[model samples]
Target: MSVVPGLVSITFRQLGVGEILALLRRTGLEAVEWGGDVHVPVGDVAAAKRTAAATADHGVRVAAYGSYYRAGDHAPADFDAVLRTAVALGAPRIRIWAGAAGSADLTTQQRAGVVGDVRRITELAAGEGVEIAVEHHPGTLTDTLDSALALYAEVGHPGLRPYWQPRLGLGPAEAVHEAGALLPGLVTVHVFSWTADGVRLALADGAPLWQPVLGTVAGASAEAGAERYALLEFVQDDDPEALVRDAVTLRSWLGGG
Candidate 1:
């Protein structure tokens, strides 16, 4: 699979849909992952369709539907709507949170519940021709790479994949090592740069980390038979112009610049 640079709409959620599309186009990025919050709310089929149409008109791919559907956090009754929204949005995958509790803090029953919920959701998404990918984020079961692998192993579903990012607290080498370990199940990536203290930095500042991570994923995608994307999720202080530099940096990392 070919790796490409794209934008996650949530980073610029304050902007209108047309403005977001224009920003994406001007940056020469190839795709977008539309967030369910603000950009395309859940259960809003009409809005999703319209956004999908607008994105296509500008010749950009809807990489995935960035849904906030936490597996163990939301009501089971609500998942069908999320799946339907993804289908309407023309997204091949739906990005979701692993569970409400972090892996380290989960009880025995809680772990089982999270695993069962994710497995159920994966099957549900499969029926709709959409894939389920858990977000690698804090306060979720996949907060760390080991837990991410464990979650996938326990769920034991081929349809379940993970969306990885540079884990905040780890150094570049450690982060790359962790990312490499999750290569087998990684489907999407949220790209950004931040210090150990959580201060947002320029994407280019994370080059040492992103370069090897992207290279590893690019090779994995080629053998895995699907396209993978390193989406620019956040820029310095939500600045739009920073995206211009981020786009160039992303292209360079992907060897397209």
Candidate 2:
């Protein structure tokens, strides 16, 4: 199966749903992950449904619900609403943060809390036929590859998956290895290029790194016949022009040209 070149709508925070869909269509992208923090707020069923419909109207699929539902930090009631919103948006999966603290900084109690929540949430999502994914991010349990793997082992839920991203501080080789290690459980990828000091660069600047990451992901997806999306995340200066240009770069990276 071919890996889909997609966009995470939050990357274009300034644009409304209509504008975001239009921009995505023009980029020749096939899917979008709508952000709950902005484009579709949790519990806003009407907005979620409308955005989902608009995406389909533009010939784009709702890849996943990019929710800010931080596991172990929020209440069950909040998670319930998050699931409902995902159902409304017709998202196959819901992306969440691992926890409030980094793996190194987490207390034993915190780790247990996160594991329990992840396990519970996985079950909750399963009931709705929706998958749950933890974003590989800093200040969360998935800050490091080892920590992410360990968290998965602790949860051990088939419904749980990781949304892998190129760790900002790592070199190209290390980033590729880190993403590869999560292959068995990877459900989606967030693509971006940034410096150790948090400086955002054009997506093409990381081509040497992203190319292999994409290849690894594509290889795995091909074997399983499961769809995977390499969605553009943050762009330089949040400029729509930069996003358009990056989408072009991403298309080429996905072997479009």
Instruction: Give me the displacement of residue 250 in model 2, in angstroms.
Output: 0.6
Error of 1 at 242 (Å): 0.7
- 10 residues in a row with least lDDT, candidate 2: 166-175
Residue 209 in candidate 1, Cα distance off native in Å:
0.8
- Runs off by more than 4 Å, candidate 2: none
Best model per lDDT: 2
lDDT of 2 by residue, 1-257 (tens): 36898999898888899999889888888899999989999999999999888889999999999899888999867899999999999999999998888998978998999889999999999999999999998899999888999999998888998898876578879877888898877878898899878899999888788988899888988888887889998899999999889989999888875
lDDT of 1 by residue, 177-218 (tens): 877888777777889999888899888888778888888889
Write down the TM-score for model 2: 0.97
Where does model 1 exceed 4 Å of error? 223-225
